[model samples]
Target: MKLKTALPYVLLLLPLAAFAAPGSQSGEIRFTGQIVNSGCAVARVGALSAAQSRQVEIKPGLKVEVDTDRNACGHQSLPISMSYEALKTSTDKGIVTITYL
Candidate 1:
């Protein structure tokens, strides 16, 4: 008896439910950007023989790129070594002195 009264309304909603979301939907979203550093703390600006390894020799004309697992700005490695966390903290505090030989 109640079904007879609700039959038309249920029939109307059946189409809406079936077509609301036909099937599963999926895809992908990706993002990209550019980061440019205007300058760095050193005697030279852009020109430096850079190596992405620590085992490489550090000569006067060479700027050994170190701790680059994070960004491209980690060059200018020295005879000294410091953990990335420490270096970041040090830099965040103030300018890190680079003694000239």
Candidate 2:
């Protein structure tokens, strides 16, 4: 009974405790990997608020479909814009073929 009452508060502080532990120290993490049939990787993912969703703009492009999207989440019809941060120019391209057995 008591544990249940304190559970949420405890859970919140658990991470804080870990951060303050004796061996805890600031650090940086870097990732490097290669992907086939893809030019740019997914930098990050997040949810869009109501205002953010409304400001989405669409552009013309060839349609590439993923047969099964294992990473699909959030509301359908939410707009996502592509930026060419990893590409040399807006005309750069990538070929992504998804296959799963």
lDDT digits (tens) for residues 1-101 of candidate 1: 99999999999999999998657556655569754532222323343344433332234333333333223334553434322222465633333344322
What's the lDDT for candidate 2? 0.39
Give a tens-digit lDDT track for model 2, residues 1-101. 99999999999999999988877346856579854322211221233222222222223443332211222212343223443232345455643332221
TM-score of each: 0.25, 0.22
TM-score winner: 1
lDDT of candidates 1 onward, in order: 0.44, 0.39
TM-score of the candidate numbered 2? 0.22
- Model 2 has how many clashing residue pairs? 0
Candidate 2, residue 41: Cα displacement in angstroms equals 50
Lowest lDDT 10-residue stretch of candidate 1: 38-47
In candidate 2, residue 86 scores what lDDT? 28
